[model samples]
Target: MNREPNAQLIAVMDEAQVSNKGLAKRLRDAAEQRGMNLGTSHVGVQRWRDGAGIKPETAALMAEVLSTKLNRRITPSDLGFFSQLTPATPPAPPSVGYPSTVSDALSALNGLAEEPPKGPDAGRLIVPDAELSSAVLSWMISRPDGVQADQPASQRVGMRDVHAIRAAAETFMQLDFKFGGGHGHKALRYYFRYEVLPLLNATFSEQVGTALFGAASEISQLLAWSAYDSGNHRLAHQYLTSTLRLSQVTDDRMFGARILSNLSHQANYLGNHAQAINLARAAIEGAKGKATPRAMSMYSAMEARALSNIGDHKGAGRAMNEAERYFERAESSSDPEWLSYFDSAELMGEFCHCFRDLKQRRESVQYAQRAVDDTDPRYVRTLGFCRMVLAQSQLLNGEVEAAVATAGLAVEGGESLQSSRFQRYVTDFQAEVSAYASNPAAAAFNEQVRDALARLDDE
Candidate 1:
């Protein structure tokens, strides 16, 4: 522990564009994904940077995630880590990679949230495939977390505290809808760590506790989406897993299904085709007879995406039909606030992406147009995604000029939106259209995308 700065580590991180804290988080996430209970924070990273050695195993894990990201083989030595920084610890217990108790869940959350001892924890993140499925399966069938009530009230908490939390969550939701997830995650994480966590561990009645879990789950859901939109997939997975456990503990089946549907969405994006399918089905089955029409519709919509990814065209069509049918049955008054986003425009957006994957350009354009036309202006990010789908559909139809025009609109709208995935759509569009670069229209579109993205990155 000479505490001498490890210049080699600094050079590697600088080259990789990873902050010290981001590297710290990626390691803990990698360990958790592999079902290890070990944790690492920015402080350890600071120590390593200060000439402290890293555990060989931790260094290897760090190399793994980083290597995979950079599309190359990385070694512990490449990261300037110590030849050995492993801690002496008990062996990892045999279990799926997910928390089984409040303490475990909290530990997982803290691992995700903690930063390098000296710097802000920041980065684009993602959910790992094994971890997503493992967490989803456990929440579906696992025993209760046995969160006990406070025998003697340690702190006086009333409906006022509960209401305050709910209101804060709603405000964050509105901010996310109006601006983008990036605009809210930092604030959301801060609130969760300070305002909310203390109350979670404080004393309360059964009614209060029930309300608290539900409220907290909703807020956590917001954080999950915020992370996803921000391009932190593994971190998003962590949040979803934590929230799903809380939903089950609260016996909030409806919310549980919602969490699963969100997981499916992320899974499909990450190409975890089978996991996406299973998660969607689990949502439907776990919430059977309990999910509102809107909720079920969203779940089916996710299944459609999974099916499309796996080349199950027929299954995708059936799932799409099921989603439409469920939407038709949804009642406004009976729907929860969370499910309200799954409206007509949202359903059409789902259809747009499904048909795009199925190579049915006409249908894709049809639904995409509808989604773009109908989605509320308040939901800026959703609208941006729909436009990207429409742009892609236009390309599939050989309408390059129209596609570029639509894509321009998406980029314009995207400026006000704060989502890394949304930016991904921009890049995906560029790559897809670039293949047609021989076409004059396509060449022009390429220039537009190059310019648009430069501006977006500057933001």
Candidate 2:
């Protein structure tokens, strides 16, 4: 069969200044790096360029190589591998109408329950900055209304049901903090789909309805966080949006602000620095009077993170100062039960992140030390993340030995946790430490990380 020449592949290969021979070599090298042995040559590259069909797995591997070389995400479709792209771009999520009212919010949540899983393999579905901004604006301008049973279903719900949900949500949150989001993720989803969704439709008084919605919102927000941690961005977005709608119905402005803060954190993680900044600011603005100082401090710290990410040193400094001031004013007694986790240790971790991004290695290391030292041992994921930050800071400070030691601890701490985000941190540190692999200690650490990651992949 005659095939069309792969102009797109040829163009990108040229842009990367890679000859067919070079690409073939790099492909083999990349596969070797992944512990896979794939044979390839200039002949294979020529065939691909001539539009001969490529295996989807090989195309995905090629996309990964190009993405790493270009320092940006390059899907297989971008390289004219349309067959490989099919799995990445799934069908659109089910629509349940716009979330303008409490009923509408419930509809959205129900639709989300039926939506197909966009697991790790599916490419991210990014919300544009304009759309994100518009959502924030809508949430800000919207006023909460009293909730009541519009049309009750067979099941009866009350304060007991709400309490049960809150209890279950706390358990899942604890599991998430310790074992990472993938742990208990399926149980949480099952609970939401089977147990939680029915309560939303059950008969309840106005007061019970209000509290029930609040519980629903909390669980949905937790779902969003779990999805984000698992690298399922599309599902996370849906759960977050639905949470915001439910929060509106529950009249919990502060809770809504926290959801926005979650969005900021996700945006920053995805490299949408500008949008992250905007989302953080919106959280601060939207919860002005309702938010406790602890909550405000967390929001401001998120802003600082985004600012530092965008290289706005002065802006980040100001935001950091604001965050510190808010923390100083924060009293645990006055804060909500949910915001309890944003303690001093977490705050220090935030500072560590911002300072690291700003290249303030000394400050970053100091804050990271405090964060790691003060964090509870049970919060394994937090420890893993903070240790990675400390490792990066130490490496930048020219303390190669110390950096290697710290990164080794991070890898060990991450062993029990099943978070892809945490793995990415380890992966990044591996890349950074590769420069020092000539050092005996750094070489050992590199091998350790490689083994750990390989084990993860096998499981």
Candidate 3:
């Protein structure tokens, strides 16, 4: 029972006069446009044309390439990659458009909330890597959405609704820090769908409307962060990008810079250091003297991370020194509440990470231990993550026994959390311990982690 050839895809490719290699190149370019780096060679393209299934992320991009060529949307199903997997959520309407207008941005986000949740529950990283070159340029050039003095009433929006939105954002931030993003992401979706969506339609004075947008943007950023923690990178990117746009709409320079910083951080994690550096720099530029020093410091620290990874130690050092200087002059009370988490403990973690990348084990351990000691239990996922860095620093310093204990503490603290970042910490710790597998203590730690990871995977 041989299946039919991919005549649809082949015919489209023929009409577009696109070779396998050309399509692969276009897909990679599309990914880069969204600050992502995907590897799909011509060989993979040939396989796709031979009727082999492609990764869903790649499939979406391939469709985009064809869509651009043919001036028509082409979905994966049309290309013959359809599977029996249950639909996650109905796709947003095509007319929703980019995050250009307040109406466009809100409609897009609300539509996402309306989509049904997916099964196997593993979230996809962000997608539809549409060209944001325009988005970035506009952030630098356009006036922020000016004050709206009034809107027609679905219901008179009140101070109470604004308060509720702020409170929910704060609560969700706490939950994500303590329990990881996956802990209560559903609450976010529910809050957006049931609570915030209605308010967007509610009547409000200009001041109240501004406040509502600010509060809702905060919640949206939290949703983005949680989605990233849950290993749904694409969703995280989409949410973060839109939140950044929302920040612009609200004219909150500090918040928009912070959102860009998060996007920069994600790019670094995904091994796209060049893109990370570009995003961090863009944040600083977009802030245009409006960013608080603390916000500047956070963005600079992110740049330092990317610069160091890109083999620019001198540049990394200069940027890091700039961060420390700015942070010292920071008036925390004057800062937005969103920057609260970027305190001393978080800075120390960044310092430790910098030295670790440079292979300065002793210096790294000193700062890493400080981060672990300073980490509050309320920041459960961060505490677990810092412990892993300390453990690795100890391992690199030839303190194998202590490393095991530190790594064990991290495993205990983060085992139940669904954070890709914390999971990476565990993974890196195991790789270090593998060298000492012949040692009994190391073997025990490995077994402990094995069981913990099993539970995580099962979840």
Give me the candidate number with maximum TM-score.
Answer: 2
Error of 2 at 40 (Å): 22
Q: Model 1: which ten-residue window has the lowest total lDDT? A: 116-125
The alpha-carbon lDDT assigned to residue 255 of candidate 3 equals 84
Q: What value does the lDDT take at residue 268 in candidate 2? A: 83
Q: List the candidate 2 regions with Cα displacement exceeding 4 Å.
A: 1-98, 121-125, 149-153, 457-459
- A best-first ranking of the candidates according to their lDDT comes to 2, 3, 1
The alpha-carbon lDDT assigned to residue 254 of candidate 2 equals 92
| Candidate 1 lDDT tens digits, 1-459 | 245466556766776788878988887887777566556888887777777765445665676666555543344544554423211221222133667777676666555555312211122123445665677778778776544676565685667898899899889998997677778888888888778766878887778888887787888889888887776665677688777878877778899999888888876775556778988999999988988888888999999988875557789999999998998998999987666677899899988888887767689899999999999988888899999999988977878889988988888877767776786677666655654445687667667766776776687
The TM-score between candidate 1 and the true structure equals 0.74
Q: Each prediction's TM-score against the native?
A: 0.74, 0.79, 0.76
Expressed as tens digits, the lDDT of each residue in 170-285 for candidate 3 is: 88899899889888888798888788867877878878888888888888888878977876666677777677778777688878878878888887765556678888888878
Worst 10 residues of 3 by lDDT: 119-128
Instruction: Put down candidate 2 lDDT per residue, 89-194, tens digits, no spaces.
Output: 4335423123777777767767767673645623334566666766788888877766767565787887988899999999999999998888877788788888
Please give the TM-score that candidate 2 achieves against the real structure. 0.79
